[model samples]
Target chain A: MRFQLALAACLLTGAAHAATDIDLFFPVSVQGKLANEMARLVEVFNKDHPDIHVTPVYSGSYDDTNLKTHAAIQAGKPPAVVIMSANFVREYVISDEIVQLDPLIEKDGMTEAAFMDQFWPALRLNATEDGHAYGVPFHNSTPLLYYSVDAFKDAGLDPDHAPVTWQEWIDAATKLTKHEGSTTTRWGLMMPGTYDYCGWITSGLAMSNGGEFYNTGYGGEVYYTQPSTIGAVRFLDNMVHKAKAMPEGVTDTNAVTTAFFQGRAGMMILSTGSLSFVRDNMKTPYRTAFLPRSLVNAAPIGGASLILPKGNSPERQAAAWVLIKWLTSPEIAGGWSRFTGYFAPRIAAYDLPEMKTFITAHPDAKVALDQLVYARGWFSTYNVVGVRKALEDGVQAVLSGRATPEAAMAKAQQEADALMRPYVEQTALKVPE
Target chain B: MVALTGTTERPVIRTRVRGRVRPWLTAYALLLPSALFLFGFTYWPVVQVIRCSLTVRGFRGAAHWGLQNYARLFNDRHFATAVVNNLIYAAGTIIPSLVLALLFAVALKETTRLTSVLRTLVALPMLIPLVAAASLFAFIFLPNAGLLDHYLAKIGIAETNWLGDPSLALGSIIAITVWKNCGYYMLFFLAGLAGIPQDLLDAAKIDGAGPVQRFFRITLPLLGPTLAFVLVIATLNALTQVDHIIVLTQGGPSDATAMILFYIYQQAHQNFDVGMASAATVVSVGFLFALSIVSLRSLERGIHYET
Candidate 1:
C-alpha cells in the first residue's frame, strides 16, 4: 500500500507540472551576433525553468518585427512576448493590441509605479501610457560621440577634452578633415541617415538645441517648424554643404561604421548599442563622449522593450511573465547588456559586481551611461513611422543641398501634420463644443 | 410514314447531344481543383484588396466604405516621386539589359566547349541571389574605400558617393539590376538563337549577305517572338523586384529610389495603413494589367512563328 501511494503522488506531480511553451519574438537591430546571444540566453532560460519553455523567434529589424507582431495578432496566433521598439508600444496600445502590465505587476505583490521605479526615469515615458505600464524596459541605448583617439591627436585637438559645444564640434571636424587637392581623402564626421537612424540622430540634434522634437504627452503634434529644429537642420547643412566636413546625401549605418573602421572617417555619432561591435572590430584606440550641445546637452533613448502581445491564454501569459521577469532580472539583464553593448535598463543591473567591473574597464560604456541624465524619450507619435519620415526627408534634402533649412522644416511640418490628421481629428481637435 | 421518320431522326439527334455534353462534364470535373485554387488564392485576394481599398479603417470605429484612401494616395508626394522613379528605373534597366543579353547571345551562339565555358561565365551573376548581390555591390560602391573607387583612383578619378547622392543612387541601383538580369535574359536568348535554323543563315550567306545583314534580315526576324516574350518578362521583373531596394536602400536620399512596391510595403508594413496600402496595390495591379495588355497587343504584330 505504501508503494502504491508513492507512485500515485509521483503521477499527480508530473501531471500538474507540464511545461508551458511560449514564443518570444526578438529583433536583432544592432548586429547578427546578438541574435546568437539571444538564442543562447533563451536556452539558458529554458534550462533554468523547465516548466516554462520559451522559444526565441529571430524577427528581422525593428520595423519588420512590428510587422510580424501585427500580422500574428491579426492571424489570432500572437506570440506570448515581443521585444518591440519602445516607441511602437504606444501604437500597439492605441490599437488595443497589447496587454497592459499594470495588473501583472500588481499580481506580483507590487504596484505599477513601484515596479517601474526599477528602471531609469528617462525610460518611463516610452514604457508607460496614461500611467499604465505596457512595456518592460529591456536593453536601452543613447547616442554617443564615438571618435578616434589617433584622429583627435593628429588634428592637434586634445583627445581627453572632446568637443562639448556645437562651435567646438564643427571646428574639430574641420580640423580632422583631410583633403588631397579637390578630393577629400577622409571625412571628419559621418552619421547614419537611414530611415530610423536619421530621425533619431536628427531628433537628438533638435533636442540638444533646446527643442522638444515632438510632444511627449500627445501623439498628434510635432514641432518640426520650430526655431530649434530649424537651427538643427542648419547645423547639419553647415557641416555638409558649407564647411564640407561631412558627406553630402545620406549614408547608411554600415557605411558609416565601415568608414570609421577604415579610418576614412574621423568621428561618427552612433548608438551606444554599437559599442560591442566597435570594440570587437576596431583595431585603433577610440573613445566616447556626450553629444555636443548648442543650448543644452541632450540625447534620445533607443532600443527595444519586452511587452506582452494580446490574444494569449492565461496559462501562456503566466509562463511569459515568468520568462520576462527572469530575463529582466539583474544577472541576465547585465549579461545581455555586456554582450550587446546596450546599457542594462534595470537600475540594479548596474550594481552587480560583474557589471561594475565591466563598466570600469570600458569607459566608453561609462560615457553612454553618463549621457542618460540628458536622455529624453524618442520621437513617437500617431503614425510614428510616417511622421518621422517627413522630418527625415527634410533633413536629407538639406544635407544634399536641395533645400534650405527653413523651407525644409516648413515642408516637414506640413507633411507631418497631414499624417496625424486622423488622430488629431479624433482627439486634440475634437472640441467639446 | 413521315411522322415515323421524324421521330427516329429526333432520337438520333438527342443521342448526339447527350454524347457531346458528357465529355464536357468530364473535362470540367477534372479542372475543378485548379479552378478552385485559382479563385481562392489569386482572385479572392484581388477582390479583397479592391474591397479594402474602398473602405476607411480606423483604430476605434468600424471601417466604412469610402474613396478617401484613393484621394490620399493621389495627394501623396512620395507616391508621385515613386511613380517617376519607377519609370526611370524600368527604362534604365530594361533597354540596356535586353541589348546586352542580345549581344551576348549573338557572340556565343555556338555550342562548342569554349562557348559553353564563356556562356557560363557570362551567366554567372544570375546565380547569386538579389539580396546577396545587392549587399556585395553596396560594399563595392562605398565612397572612399570601395572596390570601384579604389580602382578608379588609379585612373585619376575622385571618390564618388555612389549610393548616397540622390542623382547617382538610382543609377547605381540600375547598374546592379542590369548586371544581375542581363545574364538571366541571355539564357532565354540563347534558347531562342538555337531555334533559328542554320539552313536559313547558310542560304543568306550563299546570297553574299554579310553577318550583320544575315542577323538583321534572317536571325532577327526569326527571333521576334522570343524578343516579345522576353520583353514582357523583363518589364514585369523591372516592376516587381524590390528585394535589392530593401537590402541596399529603403527608399532614401530624399525618396530618390522609392519604387511603387516599396512604397506599398512601407505603407502596409511599417505604417500599418491598410486602406492606403490596398489602394496603392489596386492601382499597381491596374497599371500592370494595362501594361501587359498593351505590350502583348503591340508585340503580337511583330511576332512570326515560322521562317
Candidate 2:
C-alpha cells in the first residue's frame, strides 16, 4: 500500500507538467478525403504550437459526430472541441451543452458584434443564439445545379445557358430525356435522396419556391404540408413517376454523381461541398448554375461549425480556444477551402493570395461562392433529424409510387408535430389562458 | 466412543476451513474487479437510460420525468416498422447461418482432399474487418458496377438491386451477415463433430442405419449441447448487428431494414435527442435480455443431454 501511494504521487507529478492535450472532433460531411485533410491540418498545428498537443479525431459523418460527442459527454469523457453540423448548434445552445463564445471574445478585447461580423451575415444566424455567439463558423456550402456538357449537346441544348427558373428547368429536362424503344436511355435530372441529402435539397427547393421550411425565429415549427412543399414534391413526382425523366425511388448521392459523369444524367442538384470532387472526377466539360426557382433563387445554408463542449477544465478551454482560432485563421481556413471545395465561412479568406489563385484556376469554385448571397438558414427544429426525416420519408414514398404528395405531406406534418410535441408542450402549449 | 468422535470432528473441521478459503473466498475476491467494472460501465449506464426513458425535453430545454417518450414510441408507426424489421432480420439470420454451418461442418469432416486448406479458406470472411466487409459488399451489391450484377447479367438474368429495393434490402443484409459468420460458426460445429466417438457411429452403421438416419438418431441427439450454444450465440449476433445496416441499407428504401439499435442511433446522434435515445437503448437491451433468458434456457434444458 505504501509503495502504491508513492508510485501514484510520481505519476501525478508527471501528469501535471505534461503539455496541454486537446481533441478536435470533426466529420467529413461531404466526402472521406476532407477527413484526411483535417488530420493533416492538425498535424501542422501541433508542430507549430509546442505548448499544446491536439489530436484530430475523425468522428464519422455529421450525425455520427453528434452521437459520439453526446455519448462521450454522458460517459464523462467529453472531447475538447467538436465540428458539429451548423443547424445542430441551435439545439446545443438550447440544451446548454455548448459554451457561449461571447465572453471569450470579450476577453480577447473584441466586441461580440465585431467578432460576429467577421463571418458572412447568413452564417451568423446559425452560429449565434439570441444575439450571443456560440459557434465559430467553419466549412460552409449551398446547393448548386451541375449539368453535363455532353448530355446538353446530345439534347441540342446550350450547356453555358443553364436554366434559371422552374419553367425552363422542366423544359430542358423534357428535351434532355431520351427514350430508346420503351426504356429511357438517359435521365433528364437526378438528385440524392438519402436522409441527410434528401432533407437538405428538399429544403432548398422549398425555400426557392417562396416557402419558409421552418420558422427561423423558432425551433418547433415546420410547414411540411403547405402549398410550397406540396408543389415541390408534386414537381419531383411529375419529373420521375409521370414524365419518366428522372429515376424513381431514392437515388443516392454517388449514383447521381456517377450518372452525371457518365452522361446518363443531364443535370443534377447536389451540395456545393461536392464541387471539388465533381471537378476532379468529371472528365467532360460541365457547368454549374443556381438552383432553379419559382419565386426566388434561394438555397439552404449547409456546413459545420467549431464549438466547445460546456464541461472542460480551464486549461483545456484555453487550449481549445487557441486551436479554434488557429484553425479558423485566414491561412488555414483558405487552405482547407481549396482542399475540400467548401467555401471558408470566414469572409477574409477569399482575399488571400492562395484562395485567389485557386479560384482563378477553378472557375466552378467561383460559381459556388457567388451563389452564397441567395443562401438561407438551413432547417433546424426542436427535433431536427426527426422533423427532417418525417418529410424525407413522405417524399420518398411519393417517388416510390406508394403515397400521393398530398397524403405524404399530411403524414409528414403529423409525424413532425408528434416528434416536436414534447417541446411544444413544454413551451408553446403552456399558454396562460 | 468419545475419542473416536473427537478425531473425526477434527479432520472434518480442517477440511471445511480449507474449502472456505480455497474456493469460496478466492472466487469472490477474483470476481471483485469484474463486479466493479460492471457497476461503472454497464449497470450505471443502464440505470441512467431507464431514468432518461421516462423524460421529455426539447433539444436544449429542461427535461421532466414522465412516460412521454415510451408513449411516443408506442404511437410511432416507424418504431413499429423497425421492431418488425428487427424480428424478421433475427429470424432470417439465425436459421440459415446455423443450418449452413452444420452442413458445412459435416461435409468438411467427410471430405478427404485438402481439408486443412478448405477449413482455412472457410473462415476467411470472419477474418476481414466488418467495415471492409461492408464496403466490399456495398460495391459488390451495387446495381450496375457490382460483381453480383455482373455475374447475373452474364448468365442472361436481369440484375437485381440487392440493397436498393425495400423488399430485397433486408434479405441482402442477412445474406452478407450469414456469409460473414457461417464459416466461423462452422469451426464450432467441426469441433463438436470431432468430439463425437467413432464407436457410437460404428455401432449405428452396423445396425444398418444410413447416413441421414445415423445423423438424426446418433449425431444430432448427442450434439444437443453444442446446438444450444450455437443457437444462443447466433441469435445474439443477429439481434445486435447494425454495422452492415449502416453502410448498406441505412434503414431505407423507406425504413425496411431499420433495426432497433439503428433507430436508437438515429434518435440520439442525428436528432440529438439524448433522452429519447437513452429510452431506446433501455428498450433494446431489455428486449435482448428477455429473448436470451426465455429461448436460451429452454433450448438448453429441452434439447441438450436428453435421456
Candidate 3:
C-alpha cells in the first residue's frame, strides 16, 4: 500500500509539470549586451518553471524587430511573445495582430485595475489600445542631455550649469567649440540624426519647443508644418549651418557615442537607456541634464514593451503568459533595471530593496526617473513607419543642407498626410451618406 | 530498349510514337526541375509584379487613365531626382570601373611570378559581399572623423563631409561602387586579353606600333564583344547595386544618391506604398529590357574570331 501511494503521487507530479516551449522575439535597442542578459534571465526562468520553457531570439533594432514579427505572423509562425517598440503597439492593435492581455489578467482571477496597478500610470497610454491592455511596459527611457565636465571647464563655463534653453544651448556650444584657423578641434554639440533615433530626437525637440509633433491621442494627424515645428527645424538648421557648432547631416548612434567618448563633442543628446553604457565606457567626468526647452519642458517616453502576438497556440500562449509574468515580476524588473539604465516600468519594482540600493549607488539613474513627470507618449500613427520616415527624410535633408527648413517641413507635412490619408479615409472620411 | 519498327510475327501491337517520345521525355525530365522552380519563384512573381503595377490602390479600379501610380511619380521631385541620379550613377560608375579594369588587366596581363599574385590582389574586393563592402566604406568615408577624413586632414586638406554633403554624397557613393566593381569587371577583361592571339601583338610590333597604338589597334578591337557583355552586366549592376547607398546615405542629403532601385525599395519597404513601388519596378524592368535588346544586338555584331 505504501509503494502504490508513492507511485500515484509521482504520476500526478509528472502530469502537472509537462513542459511547453515558447519563443520570445526580442530586440536590444541600446548598446549594452541586453541580448545576452535576456538569454541568461530566460535560462533561469526555464529552470524555475518546469511547466514552461522559453527561447529568446535576438531580433535586430526596434524597426527590424517590428518587421520580423509582422513577417512571422503573416507566415503563420508568430512567436509566442515579442518585445516590440511601445509606439508600435497601437498599430498592431489596429491591425488586430496582438492578443489583449486584459482577458489574460482576468483569467488569473485578478481585476484589470489590480494588474495594471503594477506599472506606472504614464505607461498606460502606450501599453493599451481601445481601453484594453495589449502590451506590458518592459523598460522605458526619456532623452537626457549629456555634457562633458572637462569641456565645459575648458570653455570657461561652469560645469554644474548645463543649458536650460535653446538659446543657452547654442551659446554654450559656440563657446565650447574650439576654432583654430577655420578648423574645429571639438564640436559644441552633436546628436544622432539617423533613422529611428533621428525621428525620436526630432520629435523630442519639436515637443520641447511647444509643439505636439503629432496627434498623440489619434493616429491620423500630425502638426509638422505648424509654426512650432518649423521653428524647431529652423533651430536645427541654425545649429548646423549658422552656428556651425554641430556636425551637418545624419550622425548615427554609434558615431554620437563614439564622438562623446573621444571628447570630440562637448554636449550630446542620448537616451537615458544609454546611461549604463555611458557610465561604463566614458573615462571623462560627465553629467546629465534635462533637454533644453524653447517654450515648454517635454520629453517623449521611449522604450520597448512585451506583447503577446495572435495566432499562438493555446499551449504556447499559456507558457508565454507564465514567462511574461516571471520576466515582469518585481524581482526581475528591478534586476533588469539595474542591469540596464532604463527605469523599471513597474512601480512596484522600484519599491524592491535591491532597486532602492541601486538608485542610491547610482544617482544618475534617478535623474531619468524624475524626468518621468514630464514624459509624454511616443508618436504612434495609422502607418507608423511610413509616416515617421516622411519627417525623418525631410529633417535629414535639412541637416545635410539639401533643403531649406521651410521647404522640408512643408514637404514632410504633405508626405505624412498623404501616407496617413488612406487610413484616414477608411475611418475618418467614411460616413453614411 | 524496345524496337518499334521491327517485324513482330506474333502480331504484338507496337507503338512507334512511344519510342519517338522517349528521347523527348528524357530531355523534358531533365528540364522539369529547373522549369518548375523558374515558373514558381521567378516567372510567377514577375507576372504578379506586373499585375500589381497596373493596380489602382486607394479606391478600387480608380486609377487615372490606368496610370495613377505612374502618374503620381511625375510630380514627385524625389522620384525625378532619383531617375537623374540613377543615370549619373550608371555612367559615373561604369566608365571609371571599365577604364580602370582595362588598365589593371593590361598591366597585369602577363603570368609572371609577381603579376599573378598582383592579379589576385586586385580581384580581392569582389570576394567581399557588396553590403559588407559598403559597411567598410562607410567607416572610411564618414563625415567628420572618418578614416579617409583623418588622412585628408593629415595632408592639410580641409575636412569635407564625404558621404554627408549634398554635392559630394553621390560622388562618394560612385567612388565606392567603382572600387567594388572594378575588380569583378577586371577578371572578364583579363579573360578577354588571354584569348587575344599574341601573334597579333607581335604583328603590331613588327608594324612599328607603340604599346598604346598596339593596344588600341589590336587588343581594343578584339575585346569588343567582352566590352559589350561587361557593359550590359555593369548597367544591370548600376540599377541594382544599391547596398552601399542603403548603408551609407539612404538616399539622403535630399535624394542625391537616390537611384531608381533604392527609390522603389524605399517606396515599398520603408514607405509601405506597394502600388508606387510596383509602378517604379515596372518602369525599371522596361528600361532594362530595352537596354538589353540593344546590347544583345550589338553583341551579335561585335563578336570576332581569330582564325
Candidate number achieving the greatest lDDT relative to the actual structure: 1
Model 2: how far is A344 from its true place, Å? 2.2
Candidate 2, residue A135: how far the Cα is off, in Å: 2.1
The positional error of residue B186 in candidate 3, measured at the CA in angstroms, is 0.9
DockQ winner among the candidates? 1
> DockQ of each model against the real complex?
0.59, 0.31, 0.38
lDDT per residue, candidate 3, B1-307, as tens digits? 3553464443434445555777899999999999999999999999988888777777322453267778887777778899999999999999999999999999999899899899888899999998999889877876557898788887777667777667888998999889888999999999999999998799889989999899888899899888989999999999988888877777876567789998898787665577788889988889899999988897868666555
- Residue B203 error, candidate 1, Å: 2.1
At residue A283, what lDDT does model 1 achieve? 91
lDDT of 1 by residue, B1-307 (tens): 4653565556678868866887899899999999999999999999999999999986555789999999999998999999999999999999999999999999999889998999998899999999999999989998878899999888889888888888899999999999999989999999999999889899989999999999899888889888988999998998899999998888888898899999999899877888999999999889988998999888888878883
lDDT for each residue of candidate 1 in A241-303, tens digit (9 for 90 to 100):
878999998988888999899887899999999999999988999999999999999999999
lDDT of 3 at A246: 94
Which runs in model 3 stand beyond 4 Å of their true positions? A1-18, B1-16, B57-67, B73-76, B305-307
Q: What's the CA error at residue B304 for candidate 2, in Å? A: 6.5
The number of clashing residue pairs in model 3 is 0
Judged by lDDT relative to the true structure, which candidate is superior, 1 or 3? 1
Residue ranges of candidate 1 with Cα displaced over 4 Å:
A1-17, B1-18
Instruction: State the lDDT at A402 in candidate 2.
Output: 82
